[model samples]
Target: MCMKHRKLLTAGIGLLLTVILIALVRLVDAAPIGAQGTSIGLSHLNQFVFDLFGVNMLWYNITDWLGVAAVLTGFVFAVTGLVQLIKRRSLLKVDREILALGGLYIVVIGLYLFFENVIINYRPIIMPDNTSPEASFPSSHTMLVCVIMGSAAMLINRYIRNKPLNRILRAVCYVIIGVTVVGRLIAGVHWFTDILGGILISVTLLSLYEEVISHGK
Candidate 1:
């Protein structure tokens, strides 16, 4: 299939997975875990995941710090785009791909807010430090790191003419994404489905971003 067709197909699959995940969450929520009516999570795997890794303060700390780094990286990219726009004095001249990257970040943030506020899925284990039972489905950390770092890799491939440096950047992105995802899972604070949902949403958003940017060029 053509590149555009492939991207469209992949985007569709990603969105489908996200919808299915939502349905699964609702199903799980119907069966509350305790008298408090706290949503349990994906019925089959939630228990297994919790039992496998009771709780790891170290993993929690690692994931939290790494997540902050990812957010900062996203801000850096946004600032880079704004700087380019300022220097060029034209949004079109600032690199259409970078604009698309900014748009992608906005979309990711919007989704984060919508999911967290509208479709609340409390974390599997609430930390004492946290004030509220923040939504866990479609993990914000995994989604943000995946999109921001994933976009960084794409930008590096497209613009960073230095082959060695490009390779290094790509490797670093891969390592960060892997560690963040695994760390969140191993931390045992979020349900397995939450991680899965994040992966799906990230894939969908990235695929759509790539398709739009490719066509713009």
Candidate 2:
């Protein structure tokens, strides 16, 4: 493997291992505390998060819009690439990149979904009574949006020489990822451990893509 690819793989692995170890430690400690202890701690956090979400109704609006936006964003990029591939030109290289990235993304997403649904089972510490079997490990939603938006924003920032535009776009990417992280934590859809795991997995995978796949092209 090339140096860059090796570096990315190493970085990703390090992150994943660190997250896993931390989680294992937390789980061990948490098991003894029981739900009541977890609930008491989370209640304070919940109130804080809910307030932020309700503030000026901005976060709430964003929360409502995120699901539609994420789906639309993925669709828009996929269709754009398909259209380009049909024409095959100024967009061909980009289209190829998209196709490759999209394929990898599907695999990663499948793994996450499968683990969440079938293999790895962990009830939310905050809401144990939930029967939906929501996968509490690694908030896939946050991780997906982060890598998707973060990678896009970074790529665009590359071609656009404009200082202001690039900065703004990159900032937007950070905001999207940041809010998504906060959203998951505050919404109680996942435990804090879950979100951390998600970031480690997604970042590492994307880093693998960036260094290995991108370098080959």
Candidate 3:
């Protein structure tokens, strides 16, 4: 098959995986919230983690801030992609593709929201006093970090032929993803399935985005 056909096939597979993950998450929801399951948050694990890591005082505060930071970084990329597209409107090659990918990203997220409502009604069940808006089962914040930050790192590595620098940037990207995933897991704010769901869905979305918009028409 040609490159375009391969890309389309890849995108289809990613989409299929996303659908399967959503179904799996819903099936898992058959277990009631508070029985043997209890509240699935990581309060205890996080507590011990914070104490051991010596960051208990700061973990909660930083995690809240990190959520905002992660989203804003995605916005930065979307804006930059748009600007680049406009700057090269006449040419409209890779820049245009990047901008379209950004748009596709939003669409995938919209579907994610709709699926959560219809499938599991998975809303982030946070503490009563917490201020952040509730979104659950596939942490959108973590998903955003994975796609936006991950894409940025991919772009940098693609452009920078320098091996050492590319490796460093990729490593940083991995670190960000790792910290965000672990921090959420430890904080006990999100059920572990919520995070696993988030990661699986995010990977599927990112994969589709790459297969489709990252390649040319």
Candidate 4:
């Protein structure tokens, strides 16, 4: 790999390690003590987050739909890449860099599903009508938005030569990321640590993706 890619990969790995450490801390310090005890999160940051942004169902639903849109955008790119592979009639003809990205997308989805089923952090607020608790840590919506849109932006930058369009695409991705993060937090559907974890892990994955793709290209 080139020096730049090496550096980026190293940085991303470092960030991922840090995020894991944070997760450990959350598990140790933030677990609900007992029925009477408070749910301490990220050293009590969850309460602060709740105070800052109470709850908004509208924002929650809006961001949720946007996350789906982001996933569809990533799917579009995957389809485009698959079409290239079919038309070329040879795996070797497909851009190895982009193929790596397809694998990364699968990894992202797998992680999301794993975390959702495993249950690390519980939601701050229970559903109004439901008795079951919601899994809130490492906000899946946040991760999806970051990974799908972020990956889409990177692919656009790689293929689209028009500087203006490249900037526009990236800007749109950034805006979506911002709104998703803020909206999820304000919606009070997840703890503050959950959002932070989502951002950290997704960015780490994206950085690793870029590093590998750059070397292949």
TM-score to true structure, per model: 0.92, 0.70, 0.68, 0.86
Q: For all the candidates, what are their Cα RMSDs to the real structure? A: 1.9, 5.5, 5.5, 2.8
TM-score of 2: 0.70
Q: State each model's CA lDDT, in order.
A: 0.82, 0.59, 0.60, 0.78
Q: With candidate 3 superimposed using the best TM-score fit, by how many Å does residue 87's alpha carbon deviate from the native? A: 2.9
TM-score of 3: 0.68
Per-residue CA lDDT of model 2 for 50-109, tens digit only, reads: 445432334434654674565566676688777776777665466545775687569667
The true-versus-predicted C-alpha distance at residue 162 of model 4, in Å, is 1.6
Better of 1 and 4 by lDDT: 1
Q: Residue pairs in steric clash, candidate 2?
A: 138-194
lDDT tens digits, residue span 138-217, model 4: 78889889988887788888888999989998899889999999999899888777788888788788787777777744
Output the TM-score of candidate 4: 0.86
When sorted by lDDT, best at the front, the candidate numbers are: 1, 4, 3, 2
Residue-level lDDT of model 1, residues 75-96, one tens digit each, is 8878888899899899889888
**Model 4: clashing residue pairs?**
none
Clash pairs (backbone) in predicted model 1:
none
What stretches of model 4 exceed 4 Å from their correct place? 1-28, 31-40
Evaluated with TM-score, which candidate comes out highest? 1
Q: How would you encode candidate 3's per-residue C-alpha lDDT over 47-110 as one tens digit per residue?
A: 3443453323254456566667657766776777767767777535546446655766777579
